[model samples]
Target: MVDSPDAFGRLWADDYPGDFLRDLAELGDRMSGRPGERRAAELVADAFRDAGAREVAVEPFEMNAWKRGSTEFGVTNPVERSFEALALPYSPSGDVHGDIVDVGHGTPEEIEAADVAGNVVVASTETPPGMDRLYHRMEKFGHAVAAGASAFVFANHKQGQLPPTGALRFDREAAVPAVGVSAETGTWLREYADRDGEVSLSVSADTVPGEGHNATGVFGPETDEEVVVLAHHDGHDIAEAALDNGCGVATVVAIARILGDIDLDTRVRVVTVGGEEVGLLGASALADTIESERMRSVVNVDGAGRYRTLRAFTHGTPAFEGVLDSVSDAASREVSVDDALHPFSDHWPFLKREVPAVQLHSVTPERGRGWGHTHADTWDKTDARNVREHGMLAALLVRELTRKSVPRPDADALAADLESRGLRPGMEAAEIWPAHWE
Candidate 1:
C-alpha cells in the first residue's frame, strides 16, 4: 500500500506540504484551554496521543499565571491626549502621573543627552532598535529603571495589537510603573519634548505578579544520554500562536507522532516550555531538573514558521555538529544556517547544564531571521513545508543522537564547542546598568 521508502522520505521532507498545515490548523481549536497548566497539560498530552506517543504524562510544577483587568492611560502635555495601555506581567504597579521625559533608548551618552532621571520617559516599546528586536521593548524599560526614572510610555503599539497582552520581562526586575499610548497620543508627547515646561501623564493598570508553569511530555523514562526538543507554548493571549511557535508545537506534535511508539534506546523528551516571553523561565526550570550526565543534546525550536531560513546556533561537539549537519543536508530547501551565535535563547539553559544545544530560528539582522516576538508573528507567516521540515530535522536529530549506537561529546567537549562558537559568553561585559530602566 505504501509507495516506497523514498516516498516516505519525501513526505518527511515536507514535499507533501499539506501535512503540517493540517496539523497546525487543528491546534487552533485546542488553544482555548484555561491559561492554566491543566490546559497546556491536557492539550500537549492530546498532541502526544494523536502523534502516537505512549506513556504520556503531565509533569506539573507550581507557577504564578496572571491575568489582566482594566488597564488604562491618558496624557496632558502641550496637547491633551488620552488612550489605552497595559502594564507588563510581573511589573510593579503605581498610579504614575508625572512630567513626560524622552529618554532615547541607547548607551550612557544617550541618557546623558536627556534629563531621564525622575521623569516619565517615552521611547519605542523596544530598545537599541536593531540589536535584538525579539526582546520586545525591554532594553528600554531596564535602562529607564536603572536611571531612577519614575515611569515609561511605549510608542510601538501605536498601530497594532501590542498595547496589551504583549509578553514583557525586566532583566533585573522592575521598580516603577509603565504603560503604552496610542500613536496619536505618542506624537503629542513627542511634541512636548523640547517645550518650555513639563507635561503630566496619568496612567494606571490592573496587573498582578506571578510565576508561569511549563508542560513537559516524555516518551520514556530518563537516561544518561537524553535527547530533548524544546518549544515555548505560552502566548500573548491575543491571537492563537499559529506561527510564533504553533509551528514549533506542530513540529513537536509531528515528532511525537513518530517517536511515541518507538522503544527507546535512549531517553527522549519533548518539552513545551512556558513564558519564554518573560524570560527563559521554562528552559531554566528544565535546566535545574537535568543531570548533566544524562543530557546528550537539546534541539530548541522557537519562531519556527515566520522566517524561511534554517537559522541555527550550536554548542558544537563532533556528535552534535554531525547531527546538525546531517539535518541541514537532508532539508529539502537550502535554508540559511547562520554563523552568528546567541546564548540568549532556551538553548542557553541546556548548555549551562553541560548539554550541547542549538537553536532553530530565522531572520536575524545578519542572516535575516523573521520578526519572532512582534505582533506581526501570525498564522499567515507560517509555511507548512517549513514546519514539516522542522519536524523532520528534530526527529532525525533525536534519533541519531539517542542511538547506543551513537557516540556523544563529553562535558569538556561540549564547553569547548560552545566557546568556539562565541556564544557561551554571549554579550560582552557592560560597565553600568542601562539608563532608561525605571
Candidate 2:
C-alpha cells in the first residue's frame, strides 16, 4: 500500500488512472440479460487474475431474462402526436389502446383517487412529497396495476426528450404493458388530463430463463469473517450504463490492483455482481449461500464516478462514520455519508439480512436518477478524474473496513433502523421490506 502522501500521489497519477479507464472500456455497454453483460463478468474475473488475486472464480445463477424489442406510444385523441418511449423490462409484449389518465407524481393517494380502470395511466418517475423517499419506477407501475389500469407510462422528471428505462423486480412480470416517456411528453399528456383524452401504447418484449454470473476474487488471508467489496457489472439495455455501474466496477478493479500485495488479517472478497439492472439477482444469490454471521461488511459501489464529489449511504451504521472520516482525511478528499436507509442497489440484499453495508455513490444535485437508466447514460458522461479519486477513497475505505473492529447489527436492530429512517413504508409499498420487518 502506498501509505505516504507522495507515493500515493505518484501511484495515482502514473498507474491506476489508465488501469481504471481500461477496465471501463473492457466492460463496455454491459447491459443485463445480453451478451455484453456476460462478457463484462468475464472481464471482471480476468481483471482479478491480471491483478494477481487468488481464488478468482465466476459463479453462475439463473434469472428470468427479458429482451427488449420495440415500443410505440402516442395520444390518439385531444391532440394526436407520437412520442418517443422505451419499454420497461419484464413488461409484457402487447398493445393497449385506451383513454389517458394523468395521475400527477403517481403518489399512492393520487393513484387511489384517479380513475385508472381500463385506461392508460400516466405517472411521474419521481416520488411525491410526504413519500419522503425515491420510489422505484416499478412502485408506480404497481399502483397502476393495482388500480386496474390497462397500461402504464412512467414519465421522466428530466427534460431533453430523454426517456428513462428500469426493470420490474425479479421473477415478477408486469401484468400491464409499461412504457417510459420524457418529462416534456408527459407534460403534454397532462394537458389532456382535464378532458381525459384517449391514448395508445404498444410494447414488444420477451421473457426467457437465462444464466447470470457473479465474479468473485478472493484475496488476503483466509478468515471465517470477510469484508466484501461489491459492484454490479450489469446495466440497462438502453445505454452504456456508464454512470450507474461501469464507474463502480472500474473502481473495484483499481482497488484490487492497488491492494493485491497487502497482507491483511481478514479476507477481502471483491465481487462484481450481474443481473442487477433487472433485479438484485446476483447479490441475492450470493447472500443466500453465505452465512450472514460470517460476513463483516459490504461496500457496494453502484453510482460511483458520476460527479466530482463522493458520497456514501451508510445505511444507519454509525460505526462506519469514523472509518469514512478517517479515509477522507487520509486522502485529503471529502467522502460524505448519508446515514439514511437506501434499499435500491446490490447492497440492499446483504444489508436487509442485517449484515452491515455501505453503498458508495457520487452526490448529484438532481432530485432523481438524472441521466441514468436513459440513453444519456453514456461513457462520455463519466470523468477519469472522478473515477481515480473515488477509487482512492474506496480503496482506503476497504482497507479501513478490513482492519477496523466493527459490530454487525442484528436483524431486529436493522429493522428498527429502517423504521427510524422513515423507509419501511416505502420499502413495504415497493414489496422490498425485509420479512423480519413485518
Candidate 3:
C-alpha cells in the first residue's frame, strides 16, 4: 500500500535512486521490432517479474520491419546543390525527379489548393497556431500522396542542422519517397519552390515482415474489468529515442513495481508495446485480442516524464477529468489535462473503440513535437527525478481509476466530437478518418 500521499512522495523521491537510470542506459536505441526493442521488452518483463507481478507474459505479434538506408535530396535547377536528408522509416526505395511545390505549413487547405500531381511536395514540421490539432509528419506526407505527388519532403521547424525523422508509413509501405531536412535546408528548398525549380529525390531501403512483443503483467485484484497502463517500448532508429519513449517505459515499470502489491477493487495491467513509431501496430494488435467491454480505461505513457510536470490528453472523456483532478490534488502533483481526441499515440486504438482513455505526455511551451522525433531525442534531455515523480502521479491515478467508474462513450459521439474539434479535415486529408463516420 502507498499508505499516504506523503509516503507516496517519499517513495517517488527514493525510488529513482539510480538503478533504473542504468537500466535505461543499457537499453540503447530501441528501434521498433528490432533487437534493441526486443532487449527492451525482455528487460521490462524481468523488472515486472522482479516486482512480484503474477502471470507476466511477453506476447509476440507480426510487424513490417523497415530498415533505414541512404537518402539523396538535391536541387538540379537554379544552382545545383545537394542538401543533407534522412529517409523516413518504411519509406520505399525510389528515384524521382519533379518540380518542387512548397505547401507552406502543410495545412489541409494548402495541400488541397496546391497542384502537387507528378511533382515533389515540401511541407514544414511545424504546425501553425490557427490549426486546432498538431500536424503529424505522416499526415503531411499523406496530403502529398493525396495530391499525387511523386515524393515528399518534411523540413524541421527547429533552427539546427538536424533533420527530422519519423515513420512514413505503418503496417504498410509508403507510396512515395519521403525524406526530412533541417530548417536551413528547408529555406533553400523554398527558394526552388518559389521559382518552380526541378528537384531530384533518391531513396534506398529494405523491408521485411518481422515480429515484436508486448510485455504484459497483471497487478492488483482478479477482476473482470481491467485498467491498462501502456507505454511503447519501440522508438526511431536515428538516436537513443530516450525522451520520446525511454522515460515512459521506465516510469511505467516503476509504477508497476510500486503499485503491484497494493490491494485494489479492479485489475491493473501494465503493458509495454512495440512497433509504435511504425504506426501503433503493437497496441492495435493487443487491443484486437482483448474484449473491448472488459477494458475499464487506459493511461498511456508515451512522451511523459520528460519534464518534472505531466499532462494528459483526455480524448473528450470528461469522466476521466475527475481521476486526473483527484490524483493531482492528492499527490500535490502538477498534471495538466487537455480534453482533445488526439489520434496519434498508443491510446488511439482503444479510443477509436470508444473506451475511456488518456495519453500522457510532458507539457511544453513550444509546439509540434519539440525534441521528440529527431536525432536529438537522447537520454540526457530527461532526468531521473522527472521519471520517478511522474510515475508517482501515474500510480496514484491508476489506483483511483481502478476504484472509481467512468462512463464509456459511443463511436458516433466521438466522431462528432472530432468534427467539433476541427480534427476532421486533417484526418480526412491523412486518410485515417473512420469510414463509419462517412
Q: Specify the highest-TM-score model's number.
A: 3
- Against the reference, the lDDT scores of all candidates come to 0.56, 0.80, 0.83
Per-structure clash totals for the candidates: 22, 0, 0
TM-score of each prediction:
0.76, 0.93, 0.95
Worst 10 residues of 1 by lDDT: 429-438
When sorted by lDDT, best at the front, the candidate numbers are 3, 2, 1
Stretches of model 2 off by over 4 angstroms after superposition: 1-7, 14-29, 129-132, 420-422
Question: Per-residue CA lDDT of candidate 1, range 1-438, in tens?
Answer: 221335226436543234544444344422212344346545676676665555666554444444444555665565665565656654554666667766654344565577788887877544355553233355556656677778777665334444533333522234676665544556656677756235454434333445555556676445666788888765555445566667776667666665654445677888887656555667777778877667767878875544455556553433455556776676555545544444556776666555667677655443222333344546776777766666656666577667633344355654455446432322222111122211
Error of 1 at 128 (Å): 3.9
Report residue 185 deviation for candidate 3 (angstroms): 0.7
- Which of the two, 2 or 3, has more TM-score? 3
Whichever of 1 and 2 has more lDDT, that candidate is 2
Model 3: pairs clashing at backbone N, Cα or C within 3 Å: none
Q: Which of candidates 1 and 3 reaches a greater lDDT?
A: 3
